[model samples]
Target: MGESDPFIQRVQDVMNAPPLMVEEKESIQHTAEKMVDQQASSIVVVNEKQRLHGIITEKDLVQRVIAADKKTGTAADIMSASPYTISRRAYYYEAMSSFLMNGIKHLPVVNEDSTSQVVGMITLSDLLKKQNRGKFDVLREIEASSSESLADVKFAIYEVLGHLIDDGIPILHIMKVVTNLYDRLIRHCTELALEEVKEEIGSPPCDFAFFLMGSGGRHEQFMMTDQDHFLVYEEPAKEEDRQTNDAYFKKLGEQIVYWLETAGYKRCDGNMMASAPGWRGTIDHWEDRIRTWGLRATNENILLGQNFLAFRWIYGSEKVRDQFVRGVSRQLGKSKIFLRRAAELEKNVPVPVLDHPIRALFRVKKEGMDIKKQALFPFHHSLQILSAEHGILGETPEEMIEHLKEKRVLDEPFADELLYAYEVVLHIRVTQSWDRYKLEEENSSEVSFRQMKSRDKEALIQALKAIRSLQTKAVATFGMA
Candidate 1:
């Protein structure tokens, strides 16, 4: 009893066997080369029945024949006669330690009968990546969400990202998925807020547009972005209409923001909150405001263009948002005057750039520039303006890219790359936010280009450079495209 293997449970826990693989009769050299190409350390040797044969690994290559200056042509002469075997019924720890202690990467697993064909193979790296603390909490929350528990749904959003942290899923893909759920959660909160106050808000078709700006608008929101949004309703023609529900919508918007903050998103710092009167306006008023924003270029508009083009709708009727889009778009396309103004505003928006010459001449600014401002902002805002000009309606930057691509303004490859870059930027932002918030660093809202890790920093810089290169080409050919 005392001598029994402690790893039996672990090996049995993770199912293992073999993969759909090439047969053993295949050229040994071909199989060994394929193994190296797949980044697999060893090849699972099998016959037509898919029964395990002696395995061939790097060790076999170096120690047995390759090192002896023998050609890797024949499997029979070079392959080891007896390969180590572990029952599929064994535990993960046993398989893992066997792989680790023996320095083998691939292990063929068999059945409890000790003679069944090979099943699945387990890798140490994959097993480690899948290990996490909140795995069960996340699964439980998913179940709860299926049961219509809003609280669990809210908790799931936070838990998913946290579990991602624990599981070491690449930050990029995790952020892309997180971005999806964040919008869903925010929309859920908006509906809940409206339901809570609907009794007090009599129907006026007083349609409201939920305007999300900055990272939220870009679908690039990190873990830290508060919902920087606004609410717009059609101006009431009647005095009674005006007097009754204005305060109620204001209160409702505030409650929605409050609920979102409680759920996880912090409040916007610039007081760009939907609760603010400056951000809350009627449909007609919003139209006029958007026109003014398009026609008149100002320092504030450029200072905040990163946030401005990031503007979009998170919830409410798409028709209402559609109408707003029409107003904004028609004005943009019809008036070359306004279009030119918009184009000028685009140039007005400065991005992070390192003068390669200047950096060589002198030291580069330690922080570089805000990558969002320099890289993501240009592409993000250009798409927004382009959409408004093209009469394309979209609630998020991802939507805008799709819309433009459908219009043939964007090629699939370039659009795909842009979206990939945007996701990577969001990944970088989330990590930066988490670190800053934890360290109590100032300006967590803006992630500095320098804060990125060496690989990430280089990748982002390359992304920014590519974006600028493309932007220049587009500008030269299309003129404000």
Candidate 2:
């Protein structure tokens, strides 16, 4: 049905009234009580013409009033003047995203002339009604695992995207949500590792660091992303010499990886795990690896090594993550060779494009789309190459876009537009994979974006095209890629 359907129309009619507007000069105590009595979380602050000026919520009442030891006068002082808002023509689905993401209870709907006459308020609960859920096999395993497997976590992660897709969640917000979950999973895994293995390290709490790279780095990881990761450490001066520190870091790697695999992330196909002495390095050792990996860029072995680029501190000391990030920055300044190699590797992975004459758009069937080999990976590699060149280590495509744009590689409008495309592809991939897996039509190793609906297929293909264009622009600017 169109957005004007009876269901939406009724919801709008009832929800259309602006919160009981109290003028900006209204007393805090009076407004707070009015809000409570009206069963509202917030009230609009408006000028006499009813145009939106600001807002105050329950949070303001507590944080500004009670916690700060302020009386009724202070609550309104804490109100937000710059809240996110939407226009009247916006679809209910559009508000769904703003509600959950912007963390607002009410969106002051304004008219064309910019009068915030309190046309509507969209509650989080209002949008939750549209959410759809799909059963995931991995959730059962995640709960059951004694040591959370990265593999199970990966699948569980997949289900999150599936949930968003089935519920018709906006694609852009879904990307953010999924990336946030990926980040959270690694963090939780790190916490689990820290708790399980800290005594072995024996220093104070702040001695180690975790690195999540590749798909995890780009924040665009899909359901089937393999664990391509590494671990690095610093010399624990408190523990005396290098050997003791080395042993401690080594054991930490074994423990973390054991749990990761047992939990579900398959060991890296290249075996570049922290368990590998080559990958589990002290600061000097890591410096050597980065330099060598860059210098020896042509070797197939090191070419495969770029997958390790998805580094983030999942556990250990913030100092370690910070130090390593700094080292990366300095080291990356010299990595033109490595960035070039990454671009060469991308050529091996052909992006599926539309059979359309323009070739500007990807032509995809409603069958199996190689969202990975074609659209996802090429864009990922190009972005990675660009990110490394600029010494920016963004954990996801969305992050990369921001950093890239800030550095002048991509303009703001295009960055946003391309990210939107990338999200649509992810949403489709997760939904299709979930349904196929549900029916036992397929399992591991075969899920892809080919199963998307036609309209979705067109959009996804179009998105791939946009990413490809952005990547091309990035390559030209960076020159080496």
Candidate 3:
């Protein structure tokens, strides 16, 4: 049931040999005739350059053109614009899930080459013919459920983790799936919370955005992760409006946090949640605060800047997030002192190893080694400092590393080595968290090194060495040492 299952095969493996494609401007009648001639149920619509544009299905023709009696319409008019497409590299289960989610029978498969051109087509019939009804059926159920609580989805996520881990998938890719699903869950929670808030106190007084910071924002999160959120709304014009907006947003934040806890996502122990008054405010106020942090560059302020550098919008208006991001970027451009302080903060924090005999390499406690503070944070903070120095802002560590590579701030080989090292640390941390999750332990970052295999311990040692190299690079870059 693991790797032998045909359902786990790539979508391209089961897709039709050649995709039936039609130009977007082709007449609906012409498209229909082409489909009929080819015995195809759907036609992928492409642009002049042969890139994916949309799709035209037989159902779309009958419903939109025939039903409306618009016989003269073109495929562009009747086709579903920007239709959901699966990558040729994606698994059959993912394509199947996409089909269920979009309620579409035919899926256009696109290659990941330079043009992202259409390659083939897959259908519900094709997937059903080979897919195992076991795990894939469970995924479909979890997706289609209407339950308010995330308990069901949480279990489903764990099931997916087990399958992926057992299948020998790379840790980096596994964590990507984990974080993506969790982000979607958080967005759904926000949607539900907003609905309740609207019902109770009427519509929001202004536009607002919800953001994730720390590990979740960095997309470095795995099992046993907690919530670290930020909330910002449009400035109110009047005192009365301000009062109402504050109350509405505060209630919304509290409700969402409560729901997240109920669904097993723990609240941040440091009180960094949006429910805290310090973390929720108008967009201008948040911008001013970020500006102040950059100008001051104090030890405390530098810590705050480090955390805020990981900010990513989870839900709400992109404009709001973009404004804040631009402000941060501008501030970084002008604040060399702040960048220097951030570089200084990259120094390691020595957390004592509690149970493990090998205290030199890792900081272990009751749960185990402090993977985050010792391993992840050193590399993360170093990259952030370098990014700020170059006036580059990245949402994830990988992005930051790539930017550094592209900017020639770090040699390609060194950047590549750092990336590999980061992945090694992240993979071990995620696997450890999965183990703790099986024991129903509280969300924690520490892992016991005594339990690890010799090869894994060796890998951890190598990663720590890579982090030290990065730290030296940061010091030299910022003249901090």
Specify the highest-TM-score model's number.
3
Two-way lDDT contest, 1 vs 2, winner:
2
Question: What is candidate 1's CA lDDT for residue 281?
Answer: 69
Better of 1 and 3 by lDDT: 3
**TM-score, every prediction:** 0.58, 0.64, 0.85
The weakest ten consecutive residues by lDDT in model 1 span 1-10
Candidate 2's displacement at residue 236, Å, is 4.1
Q: Arrange candidates by TM-score, highest first: which order?
A: 3, 2, 1
- In angstroms, the error of model 2 at 304 is 3.7
Compose the digit string of candidate 3's lDDT tens values, residues 1-481: 4643443468777889689888888888889999999988889888888888888887888899878889696778888888887888887767877877778898888886633488899998777776555656545644544445366777767777777777777877776666766776777678777878889988888888899888888887665467788898888888778888899899999988876776677888877888998789887677677768778878888887788778778898888777767766776777678777777667544223222344554553343568888878878788888887777774688888888888999899898889888988888887877777778887567867778886777777677777788887887887655
Q: What Cα-based lDDT does every candidate model obtain? A: 0.61, 0.63, 0.77
Q: Give the Cα-based TM-score of candidate 2 against the true structure.
A: 0.64
Clashes of each: 16, 31, 3
176 Cα displacement, candidate 2 (Å): 3.5
lDDT digits (tens) for residues 1-481 of candidate 2: 3221211333354354655677777788888878988988877887666677788878878888889887756334777986777766554544554554455677776554565556766665555555331222333333334552455566666655665666666655655556655565555565566667765555433366677776666555555455666777776567566776677667777766766666566788767677778777777677777788788876574456556665655556678778888887777677667676666665545465554533233243434546665666677667777787777773566777888889887788888877777776666555566677778786432344334456765676578778777567655654534
